[model samples]
Target: MKNLNCKNCGGPMLIDPSGTTANCPFCGSKYVLDHRDTDYYRDFYERMRGFLHLSADGQERRRRADELWDSAASEVFECSDGRQIDIRSMHTYKNRIMTAYTARQNIIFRFDIGNEDKADRYRKNVSSIDYPSADTRSLSDFFPRISGGFELADATTLLVVKKREDEYPLRLFGTLSGRHTAWLIGRMENLCCVLEYNSIVHPEFGLDTLYIDPYDHQASLYGGWWSAVPNNTAVNGRICTTRDNLTALRETAAKVLGFESASAARETEDVPKPFADFLRSTPLSNAYEDFAYWDDVLIKSYGERRFINMETDDKQIYGKGQ
Candidate 1:
């Protein structure tokens, strides 16, 4: 019930007791929880009216988000390993809503791993490598592999077997302005991160929503009947970045982002009215080479690329070292 969430996208979060650690969803990050005692929750909820209390607008925004989740995740995609998996939803988040109704269109990616033990190992901590590690290649490297999954994922959201999951302690990721993803940069205050996940719709019309617990860099896929509206689509360019490099660039990035810890969000006064769209999310379409775009301009690959099985450029027509 209580976890950190992306300040920019409002997905899910992981936080440390000091309330300094963070993680986020989608771009700006690629960048970058916990359970306490029951008694602690009782006392916490008893007095905290902060995010627990949602405004009418917030509730509505959540409903719309759920729809988007359904539209995206429900669609299936064929992975490089020859596994046919359904994204099941466009997007989903823990407990996030908006009062101003600022919905931002974003490209989202979902990936499922083949082994649970491997997943758990990756989930245990933020990797020293890149966020969503996938073998240290920038989102650019695997664009071909990710593009290959498009055949099975048409009209369905693009989900893959993240190439970097093998790089343990770095499986989960959220980027804030393309900065250092899992680590905190000096005094990293006034920063915000938003996390969101895809929703699922089954072949039988059953549905469920998933939420990430940044408490550790692990992705836990779950199912349930939830309501959601897909974020609308438009034309936009795809932006690619890595957390490590982004962190260095943000030495003066004005507004920087980090993952979520303890459901942190910006109050109305803290955020400007003009950029509300950046704070909100809309339904996403699977037609994209990636997820939803910022403005609908295509051709640019966003985030790290994915992997595919047989259809690989892995083939060297003339043999190795040719």
Candidate 2:
């Protein structure tokens, strides 16, 4: 995929959900595709849709071919004793506290200098999560599982966590349909309930911290554990509570619906009033109550629970020629 740049200011352009237009976030430049460009994107979208309609075995073969089409980039790091470790990564994510590299079956988080304690906190927080005995959902599997930790010779700390091969960062999907975002919100509500059950407040709970198995319609909290704390703990001169988690969920839903914030979400044919109201309304006292409220909204929004399969590929998600 080729990155699209703004012709006016030479800045990167963000493709709209319609895929025929783009906007430059840096320079406020807008671009509409020419006829030739539109035809190319139309053909690309058709091929992606055809791939999605393929049989399970056919999809598997295509996935294998995609793996061969894309190669992981490698980086070498030296240990204190002069030993070298090679990391082959397919994707990289950066936040204030750490830079994460997606290395097939594991995610390697390299914490900023002087933030080693946060790395330890991450491990402890994930390990402390508890689930009810009657919970057959295996909710714990979605949280991070610490594989190992290391101190590089460069003084940065690395925390290695295991992840499933099928899980990809939710942000990789870009903006999704309202139906897709609805299911994501339901999954997030389940996760928030678990956090509330343990009285944990995850400050950085949002799209960047989330992973999704689109094929299974499942979501996972795979990042931002370093910033997680117990409910009501004071952080940066403010109280953090379970409410923060619910709020983040709403914000994430709004983002996938192409809105800047929950308050900005408007009702449309696709995004019904109930769905918009859920995002805009204030969260209930705790995650339990909030989730129950969302359950009501979910039914009101779509009437009944049905798994809607959203078939998409990298080009359809990130954008054509990007």
Candidate 3:
């Protein structure tokens, strides 16, 4: 079976004899796997067990076969220069200025006619982000990386940005547990810190513009760059600052926890008082201060940092059973 970790402490967890429960050896935290989780882990273990029995050449062939299956659902488009481009996409998002397709390794944004300037700005804003020297994290990978720009035969502009294979839109998860959303909040705070460092204000920094890899507990900002502007820029007569990013982050966490807004978030069995209070509290003056404030709240709410894995497939999340 897959190795499970404690959600309350970063300790190794041992599966109970029942095969549907696990407990931490170090912290004594216990977890009962739901039906879906149990099934997922059982199937995963069987597949991995079978894979391990195969020879090296057999494993390599399986890897290539899986890659081919992933790219099997693709569409071919003609470029202005008579070159054909194949894009493997499973989801599409449409806004006023552009339509974005979630491809296998890239997000393809096709701008509407006469929106070339907005497309250019989208690329420029992401490219201009400068991280602080103290930042040892490879933060750039979490942001957009414009890999290709093309002119299609239909007269629309196409912009492609790299995306990690594990990353998926935050919307795909629907509602999550409080502890899970807390980690997402922490990730969003980290992203806001990067934006604050670059003096960039992303107006739409919520679920629609965010992506997450649940296995790694990593969040990425991959959309809405066209609306990004310098911090303190006037937007609809209101001055925008890094605080806006933090506020949006709270709202995002609230939404993921099944709340309409941060102000409406309240303490429940799953959500602790400190976590709810953080959601409803006013953000500090800047991202740095707000992040520091969040760290304190996190400790008060959860005691210590832990890595929790919420595993499932599309069937579990959006199947007829759901």
lDDT of 2 by residue, 28-54 (tens): 888997777656555543433343233
lDDT of each residue in 118-158, candidate 1, tens digit only: 22232221121122345424422211122222222223323
Candidate 1 Cα errors over 4 Å, as ranges: 1-147, 151-154, 159-162, 168-322
Q: Which regions of candidate 3 are displaced past 4 Å?
A: 1-73, 307-322
Quote model 3's TM-score. 0.74
Q: Residue 14, candidate 2: how far off, in angstroms?
A: 11
State which candidate has the highest lDDT.
2
TM-score of each: 0.21, 0.79, 0.74
User: Which numbered prediction scores highest in TM-score against the true structure?
Assistant: 2
lDDT of each: 0.25, 0.76, 0.76
The predicted structure with the larger lDDT, 1 or 3, is: 3
Better of 1 and 2 by lDDT: 2
lDDT of 1 at 257: 34
Residue 145 in model 1: shift from native, Å?
4.7
Score residue 6 of candidate 2 by CA lDDT. Answer: 81
